[model samples]
Each structure stands twice: as structure tokens, then as C-alpha cells.
Target: MKNDVKEFFDNSEHRPPKFGVLQGVKVVFSAIEVAGPLGPHFMAEWGADVIWLENVNGGDTNRNYRPSEHEHRNDRSMSLDIFSEDGMAVFKKLVKEADVFLVGGKGPSFIRKGITDEFLWAINPKLVITRISGYGQEDADPNYIDRPCYDGIAQAMSGYMSQNGTPESPMPAYPYVGDLFTAMFSLSSTLAALIRARETGKGESVDIAMTEVLMRLSTYNMVDYLNDGRMYPRPGAKDPIQGATGIYKTKNGFLFTNILGRKQMKTLFNMIGCEELYGVGDFKEGFSFINLNWDKADYVESKVEAYFKTKTNEEHIEIFDSMKVAAAPVLSFKDVVEHPQYKARDMWVDWDTMTTEEKYKGVNVVPRFKVNPTKIWRSMPHIGYDNDVILEDLGYSEEQINELYHKGVIFRNDRDK
Candidate 1:
């Protein structure tokens, strides 16, 4: 495994030093787009020897996407016809040595391709197979089990979309939160399975459904209605269950505040010239100061809103800061990029990209580690960029590799070049 990692660095024209906790973990994944490829992307960053399998036909759906560069880094790309006999033979050989296998598409889709969890377990009993799908592998309703889905579909079906936005219109969170969350869950479950596999010498098949994972994430949104017949109103930019805890339009820009706790609420009310309102009705009850269920919520909210309209966001933020009320000026992307805290935290870094010589600036690796910190060794590769070296590592002779390429069992986008 050390030799393989060394070879990966030595073979590439431009490669950084590798440092991560998953140095010995070998992950082979055949997944496309966001939900599937993104999980292995993290493993690759963390020094797992990840081989991204793309069909010889056209490869992943993200083949032409620009944003895919960041997510596909630090991994080897292999274009193989996995449905063909020769391809399947190569795939099985890879699986035999792999610790984890991530398969995208529906369960039946893989079954028709002669790739099943049982078949894979037969090859390597300790293999953790993570199946990423729209719904799930098993369900009483075939329609749900086999439905074609993407990030938006999952968000819509999981009731996540309905919980967001204003009361009149619900919105799905942007930039594919559904897919991103599912990928994170997939990585987590796969790692858990890996621990169990090592402990008991038994591999486990994890069925990760996008909708199910999104629904799980929306647990807080559903519990109120599930336990009691009370449905919370969609608060848009407000904190759903708390008063004086939402975005307010100021004289300039917006201010967001979450005035919780009795002390904080008293401070906020006094700041807005509504201290009298804080001393009566439900406000007299136990810890009722920011409770949205208060009978005079509309009038109190109006007072707060009217007060905010008189001051600029920055001015209000300063007052809130002095008053010990949690508040912030609603910042745009421009503000965030130029933010002093953002710069001090070193939230962005620049690295070389595969598609060009220019450096790509992106968010740095999160949750910094003191030792074996993850690094981006290389940028995303073109289709089959590491075909020769990967196949060579698999013990195929140079001639045999060329033969596979000639047979259309293996493909490299740069082969002709």
C-alpha cells in the first residue's frame, strides 16, 4: 500500500505530499454525479487509495462539469467497460483487494449488470459495499424503491423543501444539499461498516437512500407535527419557533437576531423601546421571554420591526452587542469574502487545477487535524488519466494493458494523444 501511494506520486507530473489517516484504506467506487462521487472524494482527500471507475462509454455524468474539479481531486480515474466479461474480470480483481466499494444507480440496475452485494461478498467477504440510490434497495412499494431521483427530487419528497421558504411558497436549499448530506452519511456509514468488518471479519452492505437520509436530517422539522397535531408555520428567514429571532430590515441592509433567554429578551425589548411588553402576560411566566406562542406576539413583533427600521444594520449590531443580545448584520458573499474573521481563519486556499495552469481558490479542508492532516495531492483528472499506472499496479503487463485498450475493455481519453 505504501508502494502504491509512492507510485501514485511518482507517476504524476505534479503531485503534492500525501498525509491522512486513511493511508491504507483502498476504496474503489463506480458512481456518478454528486451523491456518489462526492463521498469517495473526501476519502481521496484523506489519503485513501481511491480508484474512480468510469464506464468506457462516456464516464461519469460530471465529466464536463467545472465544479467537479474540486470534488474529484486526489483520486485515480479508470475507464473500464464493467459490463463486459473482460471488464467484469478486471472489476472483480480490483474488488478482491478493495476494502470498500461504492456503487451508484438503483439496486436492480446493478443486479442486471451482474453486480450484486452477494456476488461481491463472495469475492471478498470483508468488503463493505455501499449502495447509493434515490430511494432504497428494499421497500414494500416498488415505485419508491425504483424511482429515478436526484438532489432536488430527494429534497422535495423528504418534506425538506416544504419546511423551507415562506408560508406561501416552499423552497429547496440550493447547491444540492440533499446530495451533499447523503454523501456525508454514506461516508459515515461506510466507515462504521469498515470498523465492524475488521472486528468481526464480516462485511456489511449499506443501503443509502437519498430521500431517507434527507428525511432523517429533517427530524427536528417533523417531530412537532408527529408528536402533536401542531404544524409550525414556515418562517422564511425567521427561526420557526422563536420570537424576535429572525431577519429584520434595517435602515440599511438587514439584521438577524436570535434573542433567546429572559435576560437577552429583556435587553432586546429595552433596546427597541418595548420593555413594558416584556413584563406582562406570557412574559411573566417561566422563561417565556422569546416564546412565539405568546398571545401578543404580533404586536411585540411589530414593535421590534418598527424599531429596526430606524437604525442601520451596523448600528443595531453594535447596540445588540453592547446589550448582550445575539445579533449580526446579514452579510452578502462580498462581505463574507472580505470579512476580517474569514481571512484570519484562513478559510480559503488556492491550488493547481487539472484543466488549466491557473490556480483554483476553494474552501480549505475542515476540522483541522494536528497530525496526518488531509491535503489535496492532485487536482481532478481527465477520464482514464491514470489508466496505465493503475492497470500496471493491478499486475497487467504493458502489452496486456495495450491489448485491453485495443479490445475496448479499457479506455483513456488521452490514449490517442
Candidate 2:
């Protein structure tokens, strides 16, 4: 794997020397919320020049998500009202330079705001256009085309909520259901498009519906219903396929442990001082032995629960670690933030916010890179913070920039304030 990653960098023609992975790649984004912003955020983290275009007023809604001590939280955004001719002209210029364009939202107003895939493709034939929406790009139902959706709606409709949590404790999970998965798909498709564009000078359009992404993720349950003719209902606490594995309450908190086979079961029993169950009755036949009679599972789980209750969470973790048993203590957000593993991996990035003059921190990029080290250059920018510099770099004169700002086509918060 290391060799493959090394080869990928060594053979790449456009690899950046500083970042060593992505150097000159540019992305123009007019996306909002988690679905669209996340994909481009990954690109930006990996050294892509991401220009975020937003409305002249408040900018992307994600800016107001969870404000950190940092000035602009940790996102990068700029204010440019693409509805205006000047704004459209600036956006077109960016499209000509960008390798990818990510768009979100719906309605004719979106097109009027210059976010249409066709308009983007017209600017640059090689532009990889990734459009994210609620339902899908296609649905015979008239309301589906321009329908607005949030995470909760996607979760309920995709049956994700149905399968998640206990049967009695059916509730929505915190992290947005389809958003992260959709972002992953979007990022994967963008990378694939980049590869294609590199080789064939052709870029394709990628349409990702959050509902579809969620549906694909819920395939295991869907497959059971379709292929095996079995309706897979929610299994509370216990996994249906792996019966003996579950979250067990300890003295301190919850701990998860799984003993799949009879050998593993024996190991678990021995670790917990229940070695008597090894050769007793039909248990000697192992997992296949116990699986034959469903009644045996209850007997085994009762024994396992009895053992788990004897030790505190820390003691159980140590015992499991020493025994090479698959066990983990369920950690809360606070625990995770202070986890030793995350600290060792440098998974949290700290940045100083210009507004607060205090350091704000958050989770860094997913999947740490060894060779091309990822670093947070700065905190996410305030709305239109980089207008002058960006406009100046794009070859717009000071007077022209001021005129555009005054015309309400471009925005700079400092100037506005």
C-alpha cells in the first residue's frame, strides 16, 4: 500500500512539490451545507485552490453551524452574488480556471443564480460538475426536481432511521445520515473525474442524490428483503447476524465485545474465568455447534453478561486487550476529544481566529497522510475577507473591485461594516 501510494505520487505529472499530492488543482464551489461544502473542503485540505462563491449578504449557512472560538469557525467562504452580471462574469472566469465545480440547492432561482451544470460546463468543457440534491436529478414526480431537503428527511425516507438504534429506542442519529456518505461519493467521483480529465481531457457530470447514497448504504437490510425473502426488522442491542456481540453495561460505562466462533467464545470464557463452559454439553462443537440450536445462544450470552459485570470498564478493557479479544469502551464526545489515540495521530487541528484572537480546534482531515503531511494553514475565513486579494490576483483593478462592491455584485465585510 505504501509502495502504491509512493508510485501514485512519483508517476503523477502535476503533483505539487510543497503539498506533494495536490498542487495546482482548483475547485470553484457554489455549494451550501454539509453535503456540498464537505467534498470541496476535502479538496481544499489536500491543497486544492477552492474558491467558495456565496450570496452578498450572510454567505453559506454552514458558517453559522457550530461557531468555534475561531473568527470564521473553520470554513472558507467568499461573497459573490452570482445573480448579477458582474458576479456571473467573475464566476465564469473562475470556472475557466477550475478543474471542478460543486453545486447544491434547487429551483429556477438556482439556475438564475448561475449554478446550472450546463452553464458551468459551457464555461469549461473539462469542468467536472458535481450536483447534489435531496431526492435525485430525475423523478417522474414534478415536485422531486426542485424539492429542498435536509438530513432528517433523507434519514427517514432512506430507511436508515428504521434500522438504526434499538427496536424500542428508534431515533435519529446525530451526525447527518446521507451528508457524509454523499460527500464521500462526491469526492470519489471528483477524483475519478480528475483522473479521466488528466488522461482523456474529458470531464463528466456527477449527480448525487442524498437519498440514493443513503439507500445504497442501507443495502444489507434491503438485500435480505429482496433476495432471501426475509423482512429484516430492527434488532435492539444485539446484531442479528452476530448474535453474541453487543454493548454491555459495565460499572463505569458501556463496553462492546464480540465472540463470533466457539474458539473465541472459549477464549472469552477463559478470560472471564468461565473455563467450565468449554467442554460442557454440546458446547464442545463450537460456533456451528451452538448455532444449530438457537436456545444455546441465550445460555452463552447469560454467562458472558455475568462475566462482564464482574469487572470495571478499565479492568475489562485491559483483560480484553491482553486476551486479544475484540472489545472497546464506548466513548462520549468529550472522551473522544481528549483521547490518546487522536492526540498521537494529530487528528485535531488548532487555528487562531482573527476575530477572537484565540485558538480554536477541530478534527483534522480524515485518514492521516504519512508522506504528504496535512496542515491547517489558517482558520476558515470570514465572509468576503479575501475579496481584495482574490480580485487583485484575478487582475481586477482597485477601482473596478470597488465599483463591483458598490454595485452589490461583490462584497467585502470590512468595507461594508
Candidate 3:
């Protein structure tokens, strides 16, 4: 984390001192929506020179979209309509010079634009091309292929959403869950491909499907079905596999805790002064206690909840820490930002924000390295905020850049608006 943090959001292009794992890598990010942008965003965090390519029309739709004021926006944007003549020239130049090109779109649309693996290989033989889509390019069924889908749709298709919530009314996870899974998956694979390409001098094109990646994430459920023909029911906050692992209500806030084995169960039974409950009614192993006596679940839950209610969140936390159990308060976004736990862990940092001009603060980068930890040096730029500098670096004359703008081929989203 070694950038001149103050100079970043301004008009400077000087990279930070710490070149993270992906140093010297140039990425051309041509993605329309969230899932597509995240790969490059993460690479940017890891010290990649990401030339974020937005659309000439309105840029990435996220610039025009926001769930709410407090929601964490991932700096959504796009640049240049590569279909335009002048824009295509610049795009081709970028491809010829770049190491990695990550393009996000539907299958048909990518083919329609003539943005194929072969085309990319022809431009830069050593470049790694990553293609992200809803279903993916290789889906044999045409009915599902090239179909437009997003986060919620992926969750629904992958059966991840079905495993959520209670039996009464199952619920979907927040929208970003599916997209995030796809992002990390795409980023890691792209990095692997990039490494191989650098060594072999031959590029690789990858196709990542949002639905497939998320389906793989629900491997826990898949194991039960594969091994024992048992499909887990919707769990909500409780373990769908039926373990003594859940969020319990405390006097102040909720406490999330887990008991791994019967030894811990014995400790819990003794702690609650219900030792007779241990190994009772052939409840000897695994989740047999709850599964065999489903009717008594409320009674047992009430007893546990009542015991927890005797203590506050802090007291429970101290006790749990002493007990060597995994537990924590179910914190909200605000609580996370202000919590001492996060502060001690160095998970938050102060920085300028892209959405607003005022000084803002939020999270630290993830996938931390002990030597060169990734740093959020600059806030993501406004639409074409670095057009002059970027074009200058690409050897484009000011006149040529102005001509491109005049021809409606490369205008910023906020031009004379």
C-alpha cells in the first residue's frame, strides 16, 4: 500500500511504489456490467495497469445505476465504442500492446462484434483473452446460450438460491454474491493463463460462466446428493446439513456460534446445565439430536436462546473467546466500519471516493500479501478523466484525439452535458 494516495484521484498517472503480484501487466477491460468489470478491478488492485475500456454511449451502465447512497459501488465504467471507426483504431492499438484483454458480454454479441479468440490472437499472439458471460460460449443448447442473465438469474439456475432461507419461504442471496464468485474465479484463471502465456509465448482464451462457477460453490450440497442421495433443505441462517451451528440471540445483539463435535456439544450441555440432554434419545452422533426430534427443536432452541439472553454481546464474545469456539456478533455495514475488531485487523482505510468529491473512507484490499500488500492508490476516474494522458501515452496527437471526439467516435459520457 505505497501510492501517493493524495495525488492519485487528481491528474497524476504515476504508479504507487508497491508493484503487487501482477506488475507490468496491462489489461484492457471491456465489460458491460458488474461481473465483467470485477476481474479487471481486482487486477487493478493487484498492480495491473488496467486500461478500462468503456462504451462510447453511456459508459458502463453502473455509472447510471445505484442501489442506494450507502451501497458499495465497485467503480463501474466503460470506454470507447470499439465498433466506431476511430475507436476501433485505438482499440486495436491497445490490443496490440496489452498482455491481457478481459471482455464481458453475451455469446452472440461477442461474435457479432468480431471479437473472437482468433481475432485477439491475431492482434497480440502473446495476449491472454478472458471472456465472461451469463451461461458461457460453449453451452451446447442454443436455448440457453447467448441468453442475457445477471446475478439473481445465476443463483436461481445454480440451485444456490434454493438452498437459502427457511422452508417457509426460501430467499436469494444478495445480488453481488454470484457476480463476486465469477469475478474471483475469472481473475484467478486469467492470472494462471497469463503466467502460462508469459512462459510459453502463446496466448490462451478462457470462457467463464457465472452460473457454472456459482453451482460449483454449492459443492456442500452436491456432496450429500452424490454420496447419499440426500438433498439438503433450505436452511436460512441455520446449517442446511443440520449441525448445532447458527446465530443465537443474545441480550444485546445476536451471537453466531458453532459446535463442531460431540465434545463441544457436551461442553454446551454442561454450560447450560442440561447435561442430561447429552446422548439422550439415541442423539449420539452428528445432527441426530435435531433430526430425530424435530418437534422438540423449538423447545431446545428456546432453552439455548434463553441461556444466551442472560449475557450481553460483549460478555458473550469474551466467554466464547475463552471457550475456543467460533463466534461473533452479526454486524451490519456500519458496525463493521466502526468495530474495533476490523480496526485491529486493519480492514478499513481512509481514501478519496470516485462517486463523490468529499473525502471518504472504507475497506482495505483483500487477498493480502505479506510483502507487497495491494493498495487502492486512486479512486476510479470519472468518464475519460485521464483521456489526455492515456492518449498521449498511446502516441496519439492532441489533434487526432480532438478529431476522434468530433467524429462521434470517442466522446466522453459527460461531454457538454
Total clashing residue pairs per candidate? 0, 0, 5
lDDT for position 278 in model 1: 65
Q: RMSD, each candidate, Å?
A: 3.5, 5.6, 3.5
Clashes of 2: 0
lDDT of 3 by residue, 1-417 (tens): 443323333323433334677767888877856788777887877777777777666666776554211122223233576887777788888899899988887764766678778888898999998988888887437888878878988898888888898888767788579888888898989999999999999999988988899888988788778788877777667766544568877888888877555466667667777677666665564432345135455555667767888999899878777767788889988898788977777776665555666765555677676675565656656676555556767899999888877877675654453
Q: lDDT of model 1 at residue 353?
A: 67
TM-score of each: 0.92, 0.85, 0.87
lDDT of 1 by residue, 221-249 (tens): 69887888677788888878877888999
Q: Which digits, one per residue and each the tens of the lDDT, describe model 2 over residues 1-417?
A: 221221222211212224525657887777777877788777766667677777898877766655322222323456898767898788778788889888877533355554667777777878898878877665525777677878877788778878777667666666775787888999999889888987887778887888778899888778877787765446666665544577887888888876565566667667656577666665664642234245455666676677777789999878777656678889998999899997876666655555456666666655656777444455566677767766776789999998998899877665654
Candidate 3: pairs in clash: 53-79, 54-78, 54-79, 55-79, 165-236
Clashes of 3: 5
**What's the best-to-worst order under TM-score?**
1, 3, 2
lDDT of 1: 0.82
Predictions in order: lDDT: 0.82, 0.69, 0.71
The ten-residue window of minimal lDDT in model 3 covers 67-76
Write down the worst ten-residue block by lDDT for model 2: 3-12
Query: What is the overall TM-score of model 3 with all chains considered together?
Result: 0.87
